[model samples]
Target: MTGSPTHEPWEVYALKYTRNDKPRRMDVMLGEGGSTDPMPMDYFIWVLCRGSRTVLVDLGFHAQVAARRNRVLLRTPLEALATMDLHPANIDDIVITHLHFDHAGGIDQFPDTPIHLQASEMAFATGACMAMPAIGGFYEEDDVKELVRKLFRGQLTLHEGDDVLEPGLSVHWIGGHTGGTQVIRVWTRRGWLVLASDASHYFVNVLQRRPFMWTYNVGDHLLGFERLLALADSTDHLIPGHDPLVMEQYPPPCADLQGIVARLDADPLFSVHDRIPVQAGR
Candidate 1:
């Protein structure tokens, strides 16, 4: 799971930190009309490990925030990382896909680490758009204020567009769910994988061309689907942000971690589209 300059294929882990037991199908697939089927949601924070380097994507929300929002807080993001032997001190940097509470709430846990974010996202979270409760409700004031503090403390790295964190890891701005939402692209053993954090909340969102329920700009969100496909090595390489199916599709790093964390660098056990078992390396 470690990488060097030449060995750029990093090991990516999707750590599930929170869960929503009963998200209506209609709520998740808003553009495709609505359905009464039950579709649960899982919140995640990703970990990318290389030689002496570890990058985290999207810090999970705090326990209190989860309780306030009525989400099932499985565990803290730090606790999830500890299962993989990663700690706040070991995180080199963090890539915040957006400033939503679920994604940016844990910034305070790593006060000294440099957090990378999209410039537009920062502006959007702090701009006039936030004055509207509907738009601002997704973002937590504490998280935004913490980010502002990070800016003043010189621990934030704001990127205007697509930016590289290193040789194999990068972030691309693709606004849809929020003003400056972005996705993470990483070179993995399976090839390029797009961590579609909120860009596509579920595989069906992109695979079926349906936008998620919450969005800042529908056009950008729709375009982001194509962008994600292009960024990934293949359709299966694109991982959705909140789909519980991710746990079912991809195998865990080990037997003990089943349903808790998924090893993204490995081939999935089932096809995301059909949910059928697939041969290895398919």
Candidate 2:
């Protein structure tokens, strides 16, 4: 979780998380599985550091939102930063991949940090999609209100399209999971890495061309894989949004941070032991 005082290119870590409730394969895919099957998932919010700048990719939901969904809130966004000796108010930037409640719910934590997001995402979150109860349920109004509050304070930076935040960190608009769902690309010690935020919830989603059931645009969802691949140093360089295998593939930054922090920029241990089992006969 430590960054360089020497101002080296950013090192990225995927702060670990998981639900406190039961799992369901039906929830993971679209029209493919029975609700009775088990589908384990992991959640992550990336932390990036370069010199004095520390960036958070997503601010996961808080206790209130967690309570509504019956999800286990293992740690708040502020707590995640505290692990790295960082205070929420000191975060240099916050890049929200989309406006989904799970990812954007913790906006109340870092009010002053510049929040980056694709304009399309914001538009859609408040647009016609709001009329659809099914689609609207993904967003918690309190989270959106917090963002609007920040926007009025001039703390929000909405990206019209792909843009660079700096030399080594950039965001690409990948409209699959959501219209404004963008992923982060960072230059690290290993090379370039792409953090696919719900762009590819599971590695199998990209490796096997399976899109998450709740995607907005099917084409964009599928193309996101190629775009992510293009930015990644290698196949392993691209991190899936909610795959437990991420922990196994990339070890924690330190022994003390085991299961709490994963150093993504570091070389991953290429072992089959990290791979999740793919069901037979697709």
Candidate 3:
């Protein structure tokens, strides 16, 4: 949304893979008003497609991981992609938003495809900070090891900072939830659309400038919200990584795809901001 694009815009899709229905508000936001009420969360992997080129965002975790984490595995990432006629072979590249298990657990699924990641993220996941259970608990050892294997196999692409993967598609580093969290920006028909993976887990996180409970650097996490706003066409154009509101705000590609895949390139059914609660004393 910041600049005019030289190439045709991409069509973005958010595919739901898993969910947690019992998560509490305290699990999502950090503040006095946070509640114990169910603050449901959804897991998703985004796709950016144009013509024959397809760019896959984070890979959703497998069912085994899902069961261990107590998340309801609706479908595997591979099955979700199949709905759109996409396969690993069809993906031009895979972008690992960060190395969290939910986002990088399936790295082995597409062993031959190139992976895009921020260098700092890899270091953070493997660095000494992981010795602390609170910090390392979110990452899976196998997933991290697979990434290191990718690096050695010459299948990984690490960006030092913001960089374009292709014309009209780029990645911007915005670490908050993790040391290497990055968001994907794609030129779309509506304007620049931001795929905010964990930078802001829910609309409330960004709309209210509240950090999620699991943050590596609270200050940077809050800063990521501002950066997301600057990159998106509007709040409606920014897609929260794990919000169920995404499935509701943006309609599916067709009637059959409802609740499973949302067409992010199209206008939302209504303004997404309207759905965010107006906190007391605001």
Candidate 4:
């Protein structure tokens, strides 16, 4: 049976493993205090494309690391992928937004996949800041070790600047959240989807035109936000790195237990023009 070329859609799923201890005060990140409820850290793992070339964006936190660090894992990362009938081996390429433990810890789970990371991220993680007691706590030794091993083995693809991975997909180097943070832009049925992974942690971060402070250069953070917002056709087309409201807006998974996986080939039910009501300011 001769069928059309197998062009699969890009599917993004929220692999939420845990919530933050205190609802992260939205205003602190937005430079405004209008938001009341402390926002939960709803982590995610975005799966893109299909067939023999599946790309994964951010590999949620590892359960063991969370426990060892005395942090909570509301859900296991592996179990979250299982919801989509996927295993680590199923992934072909992994795009890491930054070297943060929450987003990079799961690389060990997918040993064979080639990882795409910005070159500067490696430098920042192992550089002078690591010695500082305040921010040192955020770096995961094991995760860095594994990534180093992969780098030496030539399993990691390090990009220095903006790069195109495919015809419809590209990576924009936005150094803010980290020295080498990046956001993924994909042309999907929903028009254009810009995964502002950590570039903008929450929707308000973009709306208020404020930036999170976990950055090397505050100026770069501001510029990155503007760059991402411009790349997006509209506000709705830009997906924040850790927004709880995302789960609420998108359709639930095919089954009730899983979050909806966005399909690149299918037209989005919603659009950037659609106005999502803003939560009342605190």
* Model 3 deviation from native, Cα RMSD in Å: 2.0
| TM-score computed on alpha carbons, candidate 3 | 0.95
Number of the top TM-score candidate: 3
Candidate 3 Cα misplacement greater than 4 A, ranges:
277-282
Tally clashing residue pairs in candidate 4. 4
lDDT of 1 at 92: 92
Q: Candidate 4 — which residues are off by over 4 angstroms?
A: 1-9, 24-27, 33-36, 258-282
Candidate 2: residue 136 Cα off by (Å): 0.8
TM-score, prediction 4: 0.86
The C-alpha TM-scores of every prediction are 0.93, 0.90, 0.95, 0.86
Which predicted model would earn the best lDDT? 3
Error of 3 at 225 (Å): 0.9
TM-score winner, 1 or 2? 1
**Relative to the true structure, how large is the alpha-carbon lDDT of every model?**
0.87, 0.80, 0.89, 0.73
- Model 4 lDDT tens row, 203-248: 7676666677566677888878778867776677778887766665
Q: After superposition, how far is residue 233 of candidate 2 from its true place, in Å?
A: 1.9
Model 2: residues with Cα > 4 Å off, grouped in runs: 1-7, 30-37, 271-282
Tens digits of per-residue lDDT for model 1, 62-135: 98988898777888988999989889999999999998889998788898899999999999998998889899
lDDT of 1: 0.87
The residue-by-residue lDDT of candidate 3 on 1-282, one tens digit each, is 487777888999999987888748545677746577778889999999999889999998877888898777878999999999989889989999998989997888897999999999999998998999899989999999899899999999999979988999889999989999999999999899999989989888888788788999998997788899999878887888888999999989999999999999998998965778633223
Model 4: colliding residue pairs = 10-264, 17-75, 34-281, 34-282
